[model samples]
Target: MRVGGTGHRLLHAETARMVERALHERLARLPADVLVGVSSLADGADQLFAEAILALGGSLEVVLPASRYREALPAECLGAYDRLLASATVVERLAYEDSTSEAHMEAGRMVVDRSDVLVAVWDGHPARGVGGTGDVVAYARKRGVPVEVVWPRGAAR
Candidate 1:
């Protein structure tokens, strides 16, 4: 799965759980031949997708948005993030700055291009933040990538 957006973390409490649960449910439907490429940032949806992929015995590729994990996210999620990196079959960095940086944005395009499935856990709204979650989704759609948008049902985007 090529994951996009920040709905995994920024949603309201229950909303986060709902989106996570939905992601898990969606992952269960993927075939065994599928390889899940997960970007490692200890936020909400991305981590949940990694866990689900691991549980399903699928191969995981951790694509970090930056060369160094420390520079990308906070100290708290670092432990879980490290565990993810360790378990991944392939670990790569974008050789850029944070996910929102220009360099990373170019890198993100490659990530999405490689994905057979795109799972976007957006908050049902346009991104007003740094990460190009919205941009990633748009790219995936434009490329005719199969996308499953898991957001609150009635929320606006």
Candidate 2:
């Protein structure tokens, strides 16, 4: 199955675990032998979901918004991004040289276009910026993609 997701870049530890558990439960419903996870590998929810996919023996497909994605990520998240990138079965980088909001939106479109289902770890808040989690979820819905929102009760950013 082709699965993609979007969520916050920063998450509380409890929230992170909750998202992971939810991802685990969702992934459990699929056949273990041929699961694929598509994501940007962002610091919080995205990374957690990727890790869970890997843990469940699924293939990871990373979609980078721009060539300078590494530079855009916080220094602390660089290592995690690199690790996940190294393990990805596929890594597609957009043509943009810098990380811009437009680039991010295009990248999100790419993910949504390729996904059969989208898992959003949103908190029901308005999007803070272009290509934010809520915006991507909206995009997915607008495109008629099946979306599974996974914000556990009491989860916070």
Model number with the top lDDT: 2
Candidate 1 lowest-lDDT run of ten:
1-10
Off by over 4 Å in 2: none
Give per-residue CA lDDT, model 1, range 12-125, as digits (tens): 557666766777787778774664655554466677677777777677776676665465665666787778778888777776754455654565566676677677777545
**Which residue window of length 10 is worst by lDDT in model 2?**
26-35
**Error at 37, model 2, angstroms:** 0.7
**What TM-score do all the candidates reach, one by one?**
0.80, 0.96
- Over 4 Å off in model 1, which ranges? 1-8, 97-100, 152-157
lDDT value, residue 154 of candidate 2: 85
Total backbone collisions for each predicted model:
3, 0
- Write candidate 2's Cα lDDT for 1-157 as tens digits: 9899778888888888888899899888887688888998888989988888898988999999999888988898888889999999999999999999989888888888989999888898978999998889999999999998889988987
In angstroms, the error of model 1 at 119 is 0.6
